[model samples]
Target: MTEEQLQALLHEMTTAEKVGQLTQFAGAFYSEQEDSTPVTGRIEFPVEEDMIKESGSVLGVAGAMKLMGIQREHLKKSRLGIPLLFMADVINGFETIFPIPLGLGATWDPALIEELQTISAKEAASAGLHISFAPMADLVRDPRWGRVMESTGEDPLLNSLFAAATVRGLQGKDSLIANDRVGACVKHFAAYGLAEGGRDYNTVDLSERELRDKHLPAYKAALEAGVKLVMTAFNTVDSIPATANSTLLRDLLRGELQFDGVVISDFGAVQELIPHGVAENEAEAAKKALEAGVDIDMMSLSYAHSLASLIDEHMIDSTFIDEAVLRVLQLKNELGLFEDPYRGVSLEKEQTVVGHPSHLALAQTVAEKSMVLLKNENVLPLDKQTSVALIGPYADNQDLLGEWSIFGKTDQTTTLRQAVQKQYTHAIYAKGSQLYERDEELLKEAIAAMEQTDCLLLALGEGKDRSGEGRSRSSITLAPCQIELARLAKETGKPVIVALFNARPLDLTELEPYADAILECWHPGSEGAKAVVAILSGKVNPSGKLTMSFPRATGQIPVYYNAYQTGRPLPPGSNERFFSRYIDIPNEPLYPFGFGLSYTSFGYSNRSLSSAKWDGSGILTVSVDITNIGEVKGDEIVQLYIQDVVGEVVRPVKELKSFQKVSLSPGETKTVTFEISHDMLQYYHSDLTFASDPGQFRVYVNGSSVCEEENTLTFSLVKS
Candidate 1:
């Protein structure tokens, strides 16, 4: 439908139908239960059957058969014949699950991540989803928040790159009109990741400069990439809830960001405005949301129940309603739903494409690349011929696809026991300990199993239910039982290989001492076990780097590599007083961002600069020769970090400007080059101006964010 046709349809819609276009409900309402049975997220709305028939969208129904049925049922009851848009939280994958977004960030390969999203889009589109609230571009600094599993990482540049890539992958070149794609919704609008104390739905208060500089870039990048929708955060932005804060939703997101796409509320967020103490009741909730330019209300009946009355009572302008309804209608038309209500959804296509071998293969490849070998003292690349004991709750568990796998089937997932048996024929398996409990019998059985084997492969970490959405942990340490079990296993004098299955980073300071090798295998999706076993058996090399820092203690919650340099800085060898040093522990991260171990070593040498000075418009090229000195072929992520000696405002100690992931065989030398552009030096000044100031800069090229290599080059950025 064209714009004129959409307007005609809008004119034909009744006030209830227009309100319906701005409202969303679960597919269960259209079913026999109506309001009795609940759908996803357990939110039960008091939706009338008439409202269900006339509603604009369905919340969480997937699979072609179900979606086709619900959509057909909806159109039959929809008086204006406006197609009901299908939306779901297809965060990482649809059926063949990939690693969580954090793990995807660890790969540091946007091209590969884009391909994974492309695969995800195909599977989701075939399953009859018109839109996915995914590619969560929130920059998270605190690991205590469960939703960190959904975000890419903490850095603005890295998050921005992945955000754009995800938007491109999901929407593709045609931007969701294509039959093989689905619309991408970048969320949770602004910075919901900076929740207070890393708790979900907490307050977020920051300066306008901090907001623009640190938290808003990823969402900006996603919008620039043409994301079809933006989901509002549940928490307050500068003491105002995002769902009702016009300053953020209207003045910032829609105005400054120039995001004309539809703005959506997080699950039940608009309704919570009453409890947030901003709105008095549902009527005010509806008024605030519409006035703030929220296009769709997910699972909140506030719009359906109060929107029409508010418009009639002159509490809300009818033009706001029309504009919101028009955006919804436009999106439906953009999705080609008006042309074909079914939109190429077929049960056969869903089954054929969802869990295909190729899709699983890609998931395995991504999972292998997402595994970070955090520590290896020559115990990794386990010998297949040696008798290995695979012990822990995750040893044979199929619950590896962490939370938010709404459509994932764990039975179809490959378990570590199955993969281990296939790779190491003499492997003995034992369930050592539960995630948070101690079982003496299980521990004894595990020790006995370890005694019979040549090496102990302890698979331990948080359960799948431990993280994502509302699941936040005060202490991100391994369970006491698991730590105790690991120590007992180490007493057997066998080399311990700890395989951690978790969502966010954990305090591995305790486990690191007893374990000979540690693999940070974060909730690797359906093919998690296979990829992990492959890395252990030397079939694949570990290449994933950490996007977030792993702290030594829970006290150090909000640690990142790009932190500001303190006035009283602590030097490398400074144990002096009056410095910014922690009395109890070091202020450094246990494992810094971009830190990962490969099967082999790479040596950096002969770092040089193309020019000692350059104008604002000129490019400064930095080059370094990397050699794979170790015996095995491996891939290394050569990172380039820049430090501004002086700035208009204070800057981070170092910022990651660019990086290159290079593959090299033993004794092979390859030159990795990075071009630093003028735009790369731009920063949000104290005046909120985003421009670079001419200054002296130091560039460092090495294998990780906190590179040990002393290869540094100095250059000056002259004014144009």
Candidate 2:
């Protein structure tokens, strides 16, 4: 924009007017689902969408603006005459929800992830939303942490790439364009996953190295992708709340990285700092925040109330206020709002265009691609004549779309029972439990259903409400009643298939042993029912792998595959004293990362690598032959992982370098190959420099992260 226009905007703002831009309010309007998913909380709100525009030349407002019509009328009343940007928690979908992120991560495909977010953005942008809080980049280790379902997984490198992909999907080339896309916000700026005791909104005490190497890669990747905005975490990093940490705000984010976008706080995060004891009062919280470079406050009155006095006292510089307001205005300018504030406003096309069938198709493709077959014993892909019994709270559930599916229509999506009834001639269903049920009647019903059918499909797991933000579990086990029903089903002598509708992994020791097949369906959105049907009818082959590790028990709370080995290593085949291995149970998780099963089997040749080559100019080709040993056709994700033979410091035993998802006809042999460049082999070392060292390398081509067969390569990194 012309400096003249910017100066004109700043010139009209009184200290009070400018302070108004700094504080954001949650409009009283809210939305809630009726006939809610059992475990999903009863939090509801009215759709007051207009409160946003009514407040200002915007300062900005979270969704449910108090009055749709009035908000527009009054927003023009502001001194600066700018429109408010409507913000909301567009976690998975706005209207056409997709599967939860963890489930998407299980697919381990960035291209598909980018595609789904593209669909999500289209639906959300059409609904008058200007910005969406999405693509959560937390590196989760504990399944007990309910929000684990929201992040990708525990690997920094993989999650980093996904984070960037999500940003690109939502923001398109220019979200701030005329009806093109909505702005994307990469969230919880710091390490929110390290919350104390794996609880949400808890304190985080972490070393700088750990912070940079592990929790910060995703955010850096998002920044590099040109994300228009950033959000602060709710917890403290070291001793300072992330919302008010100047080092994170000014020194690192702005000074070092040169991120020119506005910094938005997490929901009510600015005020939350007061209760965190970092700030004395709301007024002080505002002082610390504006000083720390937080440009916008979400759902908090702190900035709205105290910024004027801070500015008058010279405690907060006018230049800082100018910088903050300019960032918001620059976005408005980028969005061409200066040209026309009504760019995205429309009601005539809303009815027919928003949740149409094309949108449903996109959701279905994502759901189909995201479903991971965790365990298969040939109980899946049943013939049309098989008399199957579908049982579980989720079997008949109208809410199969999954977590973070905020605006989805339950009736529109297909249910497991409905999908099954359409296929089998004599399919029966039983609730078994209330999802958290331990009642005897439910168990009796489940057993009865199992007795009537030749096979059983139990859909018992966490409900949609049990695994999002502010939702953590003390026990990562199957709900009590489901276990009893599962135990009983084991004795029925029928082939049992467990369809898990949970966001995170469960302690399947009691459940897995009793099941012949298991499908981890993490809340497939709108086409969720259709995706389940595809898997059941063998229309779409399930090839998704686990991005997160499934622990054998809660005792392995922070379980993950790529974790650092304990100083005293546990011998896999031998027992040694004082090692990290548990006495009663093995330290290994129930399933390793990149772990999945297919209807057909695959074979991997022992890995082979070429001799050493130069770092900057060399290309490493690692190939594998995957044969479909089963009669049916299928797809396989051949994984290639590399280990640094030696490094300046200890490193993960192996890191996933490249993978290919190949579809093969029955008995069709295909060669899958990946090229490893210097960038793929580099790691951040003691000096914070990333490089591929001059040393030998070991490569493994296997089905997943845990490779039973492998080979080696010798490569050197000469100066480029």
Candidate 3:
């Protein structure tokens, strides 16, 4: 309904009715603290039965979820009969847990991402949930943040493509799924990328160049996909809480980006502004948030108490309140809730549809494709007779399924031991130490097991709890216990094969000195074990590439391959300490962005540019030859990166313009070509126009994910 229509209808409501319309909660994520003390370190929101009766409607949110009995009772009690929007964090799965988004991103498969979102929405909507907080579109560079698991990785183009596809997928067969296809909520808007020290809810301060170039693309793509809800971030951008940033919320998201969706605060973010020192109390937090464009205040009753009075006092505009509320109601209408409130979901289907076999197949595919073969030193594909010692806590522990995995059954889930034990008769298992262990004796016993085996498959990485929301780590090295265990395995002279199960890339400098083979398995799900077995045994050759750059150390964070070159480029062996290059460690990442090793190898030829210059309308063809020089057949996600010789605005050293994943048999050769135009060359100018200037362009192509070999072609665009 229009805000005018909403206002007329709201004017007919009693104070209690008005209040009810504004209150929403997810009963599942909350419980009263024992001894009447509020829960510590858990999101807490208190709502009384009287408050329930007084509020026009209450949204059953987040953990509270949708329960048929409670929902019916609320429908019966509310004065205005306004129903609540039953919401949940429907990321990956409601019950059928899929790989996290970062894992999904590694697949470079949009159809798979779409399939996951479609299934999640159907399951969420079928369970009577109206909305899902998902497709977390934060584009970030700092891998130290735990929430990186929940997002598509760092490339703006890649993130944008997948973000849009996932959003469209979540809308489901139609607007509503069984009355359950849940609405998608793109979250943590503005510059949540500048998290201070890589911590959650830390301060975010970045330039507009960095913001638009590195961060905003994913949100833009999600918005373009017609995502109807955007959740405000926990962090501030330039000293202003994102939930209370007028430029970001009102002027940009609503006005410039043209998002007509409901703007909701991150859990307790509105109330948090008081602690952030931006607001004096819940009242002021509510006033500032609503005025700034926060529509639904998730979990914080600051809106229920202060917003109504603020409207009366003109401290905040009533029109703004109506506009926000209407956006929420419009979403309800879009979901077709007015006709049958029980639309997308039911208790029975929720039990059956979620965690079904078909969904598990998809989870398996994502897990398989996301595995990056970081390094292989000829000791892999362990023979069946080879006695393998599976050493590490994560080897058999069910908790390493990676983070943000929901409704996962650890018992039903496959561990590395289970997957290998099925295939190889000579596999021996030993839990060397707990994932976070500090003990030394356990490490020794594990080393003894390493001595007994012909080869060692060391499963090491963060636990499932270590890599989701609010789980940032300052030191992203292999936990000390795991490192010592790796050291012991190396000393035994056994072929040490390390399977890394992490949400984000960890610095592997210590492990590389000992390990013969390294696989970034991520947190593969139930099929995780099977996938690991397949890759280790050469049943599946690794093809996935690193979506985010791996830093050599923590100080080099916010480091990616696409940064603009400084005026003084690093002279490799220069003595100038003031250069952008680091003194202790090289400025380059331990592994270059887009760098991933395959079990087999391919070689690239120099790129041949078809034309040196062209008009904006024509296609520019650049062809390059690739030959499979390895003994086995494999696929290559060959990349093309471009650099503008000189531009009005400083451009990235290299930006991934286009890439193609191809297949080749041993000794096979093929010419892979790319078509370019203004689409690939044009970048936004300072004047807010996208223009490709007349200049020399450099094209690089490589068999792997990055173009290490450069071939320059001078190209000029004629004025339109």
Q: How close is each model in CA RMSD to the real structure?
A: 1.4, 3.5, 3.0
RMSD of 1: 1.4
lDDT of candidate 3 over 327-425, digit per residue (tens): 666676677665666663565767777777888787777777878888888987777888899989888877645555544566777788988888888
lDDT of 2 by residue, 568-665 (tens): 87866767668888887788889888898888888765345554656557587777778888878888888877777667777777787777888888
Worst 10 residues of 3 by lDDT: 31-40
Candidate 1 residue pairs in backbone clash: none
What's each prediction's TM-score? 0.98, 0.93, 0.93
Q: State how far residue 157 of model 2 sits from its true place (Å).
A: 2.5
lDDT values, one for every candidate: 0.88, 0.76, 0.75
Clashes of each: 0, 15, 29
Candidate 3 lDDT score at position 379: 89
Model 1 clash tally, residue pairs: 0
Better of 1 and 2 by TM-score: 1
Tell me which of candidates 1 and 2 scores higher on lDDT.
1
Relative to the true structure, candidate 1 reaches a TM of: 0.98
Question: How would you encode candidate 1's per-residue C-alpha lDDT over 128-244 as one tens digit per residue?
Answer: 999988889898999999999998888998899999999888889675468889999999977899999999999988888888888888989899999999999998988889999
